[model samples]
Target: MTLTHNRKPDESKTAVLAVNVGKPQALPGQKREVMSGIVKHPVSGPVFLSFTGMTGDAQADLEHHGGPDKAVCVYDYSRYAALEELMNRKLDWGACGENLTVEGCREDEVRIGDVYELGEATVQVSQPRQPCFKLGARYDYKELPVYFQDSGHTGFYFRVLQEGEVAPSAVFRRISTDPASLTILDANRIMHQGKQDSMGMRTLLAIPTLSDSWKQTLLKRLTKLESEQQG
Candidate 1:
């Protein structure tokens, strides 16, 4: 069950292009304040990442975002091209509200509990980011969240293992991976697409590396399903 990538990550292949952080701001045409750090600009020097998130980053909605497990939002640089094609427009690196715009690793390659040495900081993959309606609001496209979810290109989050500074062009080296084969992509599928598969849900629930928030949400869904059946 231990899956290993025998090859080391090539520094030239994997790198951080931008480190962006933002505070809460009022969305255009909306009265509510949203901490949609999606419009991040590149920082020239090292930025510190703590257990919660990048030093300057803040989340307005604590109900769903920004905790130890949901900290350090990461998006693949490769997916930008696909997203641009879908939206038929050019987008910036931090357009997805990611703290780090990363290259080389994609959702499929990153598994839950996979740890990486990112610059001076160490981070572990926590879960696939569930796109929210705020994304659509940011783009002014109401269907964007649905499109993002269905595209399966949803970026992932990281839990800071070792708080340290990270700069642009920093390389990420995979330190280790969980023995369970539940990848971020697989976890996303189980959460978003495989609702009818009770067996799959049970198996996902058993994985020790799965995020506690995700487990709780799945448990609620299962309970609701059971109640409905009994009703």
Candidate 2:
């Protein structure tokens, strides 16, 4: 997830290399299993993109995972090798629990509210994917989440605007330009890396395309920061 990259990400257009979906599997309570939907399997051909999620995909933690605002979870293809170098382990496409493993969709240049025509469906960038305990659970590395956040390789989510079929053969092309232009990298920086930057938090709050949960979080943080500054 580090800014250091083994490969430069192409931001012009995105190409789907694999489509993935997963159902929650019951895990042993003592095994650090959070009943996560992070274990995904790649699918071939076309899959229906709905307002909630893919056809077979089901999230164990619906409160944090699924909804209209997070219909699809996408991961940048460039992060795998970069992360592997840092972690010294091999990672697969679906390791990050993303529904779509895509190339040319790096977070540095990707902006919140940027609309794209992905295959037949229309989707807008909603927010950066936040790592939870499940990420460390799946990888058996308790500190992985910390490293992931620091690397700024956090993947992002897309809210589906129009329902349609998405396939591996389709290109995720940017259809509209965002005026607010808040990149996912900066969002992550403000939310996780630099919480004291009230100005950065305000910048993210101004973006109408930001996810509801993120907006509320920033608002609360900003209030707390202001109170602390006043105190």
Where's the lowest-lDDT run of ten residues in candidate 1? 1-10
- Summarize candidate 1's per-residue lDDT along 1-231 as a digit string, tens digits: 222222333435667777888887767865676555555666788888889988778887888889999888988877776666666777776888888888776878888889999989999988899989888888778788887687677989999889998888776778898766577778888888988767778878887767789999899888887788889
lDDT of 2 by residue, 101-169 (tens): 888888897899999898889999999998887787776677878877987779899999998999888
Estimate the lDDT of model 1: 0.80
Distance (Å) between predicted and true CA of 39, model 2?
A: 0.4
**What TM-scores do the predictions have?**
0.88, 0.91
How big is the positional error of residue 217 in model 1, measured in Å on the Cα after superposition? 0.3
Q: Between which residue pairs do clashes occur in model 1?
A: 38-97
TM-score of 1: 0.88
